[model samples]
Target: MKTIAAVMAASAFLAACGSDEADDETTTPDATDETSEETSDDSTDESTGDTIDYPDLSGETIDVASDWSGAEQANFEAVLDYFEEQTGASVTYQSLGNNVATALGTQIEGGGAPDIALVPQPGLVDQLVDSGDIVPVTENVVAQVDANYAETWRDLSTYDGELYGVWFKAANKSTMWYNVGVYDDAGAEIPETWDDFMSTLQLVSDSGVPGLVVGADVGWPLTDWFENVYLRTAGADMYDQLAAHEIPWTDESVVEALEILGDLWGDETLVLPGGAQRSFPDSVTAAFTDPPEAGTVFEGDFVAGNIADQTDAVVGEDANFYPFPSINGSEPAVMGAGNVAIAFNDDEATMALMEYLASPDAANIWIELGGFTSPNQNADTSLYPDEVSLAIAEQLTSAETFRFDMSDLTPSAFGGTEGAGMWSILIDFYQNTDDVEGTAQALEDAAVAAYGE
Candidate 1:
């Protein structure tokens, strides 16, 4: 797929802030007559609009709650520092550090909510929406974002037709990360159909290397597989229905996808049984640490960062990616993962920063730091500066259809329920292939119980 390139240039200076004592300011937006409709950039000016000028905020601290760990977290802090220098709005980051959803919920309940929170998971966004604790980007704000990012991200970040968050660093998960050397040795081409894909796997296995490695221990990874299969097997509409809680799990299309996965699980030549014990973080090890072990892994682009320390396999050079093949020439399924900005204050300066952050400038900053695909349409992909990341960014830009993580978009509870159900399905298929129908029924029953439909 051809991607629209991002216009990358040297970082430009933004306006500065001038305040010091800014503290816990968690007042909801005045719910009086809030009007939200998609507006173009012409209607919303970055130079002059309803945005407030940079306030004099030198030491004034705004709490930013997050769950970023390792290099990603460090990079995030650097970005925050950029914002701080420009706005003079010093950030006292309250690292949620781990278990973001739980920690943020605790702070919200305890009445010590941060002014800015980083919601990395969609389930948390759903919860915040349900609680009315989140505020949408004001009309002026949405216009600013719309001018910068692709409309698709705005649609995804918006809940119930209201823009609630600013999206950043999105990576398309409908990708298959493969071992190039292994493929070269096996003399294989990337598959484009289910039969072709199966044949490739068989060919790889025939060469005595595991054809694939998937991590199910994290639960969400399993959802990734399910979403990819659902999109390929049942098509996008059905996948959306499943996402919106409008489709029953027992739907024949869903069952057929599950059955195919079951068959794959039964094929011992396909993947190592060790994959069942690996989590998302451990998937890199299980899949592509070295040859003679595992060959390919189905995961998101972020997996690149995880394996960087283990292998010198650069993105486009040593490693390559392809979208998960469709079952029967259906359109591809694209999944996204990233953080959304949720605000707790409505001050003019705060709102201005929020609006600006949603603009093309912020997108540039994100891409420069090797941030994932920005939903920002104005963002120049070259900011990624790396060939491989740039390729992934282009993949995101050209994607015809996109959805958030399968588990995170679903009700929080179902991630555990349906995820465990799928695991059982895999185990069942491994033990007794004839039990596919029974396991499918079990999954449907479990889904019905989870959603009460």
Candidate 2:
């Protein structure tokens, strides 16, 4: 199969989908179609022995909200069209862009929230629930979620033991992309362990080629590095604690994570020049252009789209990836993000569409459409556009555990806060890797203040 270049057209639509968690034990009853006979939900979703029971809501319409536009919006519009065809509900989508959080908040404040919303982060779901919003989902939707996705996903969408949303799309962040020609010239195999990866880095540096390119211009990539290191050293539980502000950023685990990072990045010469200033897309473009400046870029799957859409590099031939190496004796822990669909006001029509989305049947539709990865376990994997996508799906599913982006989990104030929170602190850390302790303490002070502890 050809690489996913064509399919990954509108990449970066869900850049922040990684940060956020839901609605009800709804016990809402399933409604049968008017025909009272099962039919395939959509062309791509059809299977030999399976059928979908779509509810009939001929004249009812519901408003959907998201931050998608351009190609991303088109992809979703296609899915929404398919949904309308299946259920006969007129669903209108509103692209709220980056201000979805604010836009939806304003709507709720004015008692005009959309019937459903595709929340980029689980934190938005929490914000809605905490404000006494009582959106509900049918039990069937919950069952579909449990049967089709991993427990971790269910947890991400759950609020205080009740489920709230459906994981519709995801970006696996536990991979690093490199130039195959560069690797071939260096005579290096993709590293499978932390030690081996480090040695490979040294070899690249020895070859006079930079070892890695971190898109630290925005500070989030630095946060990704910490998350990967912490997941490897301290495992997932500690990762959770740090995200929830239950543990100070100066905790021993945080230090260990920072140390591990320092070991990998302390040598400024190993990184591409101007990484602190270059945008993520700029870094990717550099790697694919002639006489690449760096050997590899550590980023999520979305980087594939950036490469394909922006450069002439052939994915899998010129641009490719390997799972980020295991570290500190921990197994593979995937760090990533996804889009979650939540209801603003549950109704027969809203609950019906949600239940449909929760199922593997609905997920497979998007999977076959390309540029979409479903966490749904039962979704047929054979339909992925290419080996690149299929392999990513496999690695993501087979991971020992999956954690949302760490910075995305922390309050925006602490994680993305400009000049004061993790963002500025990590930028400083990048500039001066020797002051690991001071950096860790700075993070702690920032977290304490942000969390109001």
Candidate 3:
């Protein structure tokens, strides 16, 4: 198997940026406007003059569970529909909302778990594996994953040296979305370093609008901001150590990253009126809406979807994104998040769905529909709806270094739980930016408890 870095390097050469003409002709699709019936008819194999003899699953039913809702839920159901079309299977999708981890755990314990689920956290994968309910993927699914995905994705989905899931969706979290009109009006160029980023924000603040708006109410967004800074400041070695609890959170490197965040978050004038209380979707829209409330919002590439759906702003024109600025003169790093498809049952219907998801053919269905990206190297990039989405896809495949979200990697008691663990600690830090040492110490204490270190 190739190293993840090498895999990404090799895949980068295969990707080309889409044309401006294609971008100009594209608009974000309304989730309600498209239906599963519309999507299942299009097949990648048929387009290339090839045919697949799918298993005859006429009477089989497969149930899938995930935390997605609204537009995301609709988009994924379209992919499921394509599987239903290929094989004569009836696939049912259930949205478990924000508490999917807990809910899925209960279902598995009581022997009522869905056939398969799209899990968002690797830590949860470990927990599920330990419960002895998760079935190792079939050999056919393994071959598809080996052929289509990067080693990093495969590694993340494996537990105890056995592959248990397939990564179906990916996120590039190292992005800062800005209002184009506000940036041009403030005469600010895209910042390349931490100092320059702050200067740009200051300039925007001087131009009568707040410099940034953060949706810190849920706290995971703050974790992303910290992870990007930490990856650049401390480097990947220490990042891996900290994530595994091999290093304390009170380490100086952690403190430095928090202090960098404090430079923007600590200030009252630099943030929108609600400060840390704003919702993530509202913050994304506020940055691009008319008479914008803030100059920029920082989050994952998925922010573009919210801007398109909630507000009427044009994605590549009225709203755009730049890479998160380098911190402490470190090399560029990409922080990402993804959903892994794990099976709870090894039934024939479950195996078929898993294999299809691992194939590029299944990925292209969602990619063409808009607001989706994939780690599958063979996934067609040209199917991306616009230049913004295309650029994000390129970033995911081409980065010199990439790491999954830190919070998602740690134990739920420390990272994944709501109103507790990393979420609550970061929220408290956002409200009290002066408590830098306290925040670091609090995180370290939580890690000790969660990791039993």
lDDT of 3: 0.78
Which candidate would rank higher by TM-score, 2 or 3? 3
Those runs of model 2 whose alpha carbons end farther than 4 Å from true positions after fitting are: 1-63, 66-74, 84-114, 143-147, 150-152, 205-209, 347-349, 369-371, 416-420
Residues 1-453 of candidate 3 have per-residue lDDT tens digits of: 112233233223322211223322221222234533343333333222322336778999999999887667877888887678778899999987655677887787798999999977777787778878788998878878877666766766766678899989888899889999999999988998989999898999999888899988878888898999999999877877788787899999999999988877988778886756887878988898888989999988888778877788898999999999988788767888778899988899999899888876777777777677777666666678788998887776667677777887787778877777888899999998899999999999999999887
Ranking by lDDT: 3, 2, 1
Error of 3 at 9 (Å): 15
Query: What TM-score number comes out for model 2?
Result: 0.77
Tens digit per residue, CA lDDT, model 2, 339-414 = 7898876788888788777765566555555556676655666656567867777676567677777775665567
What would the per-residue lDDT of candidate 1 be over residues 1-453, giving only the tens digit for each residue?
001110000000000000111131211111112311222222232332333234466766777777666556666676666566556777777777535666787788998888777776665676787787777777767877665555555655667677777876566777787888777778879998878888888888777787887676545566677778877787656666666557767678877877787777668888767555666656666555665366678887776665564465666666777777878777644666667787877665556567656755555454555535565555544446477676676565456665556555554455433335444455444456567577667766665665556
Reference-based lDDT, each prediction: 0.61, 0.70, 0.78
Residue 190's lDDT within candidate 2 is 91
Q: Given candidate 1, what's the lDDT at residue 377? A: 51
Where does model 1 exceed 4 Å of error? 1-54, 92-100, 120-126, 138-140, 159-162, 290-292, 347-353, 416-435
Candidate 3 clashing pairs, residues 3+ apart or interchain: none
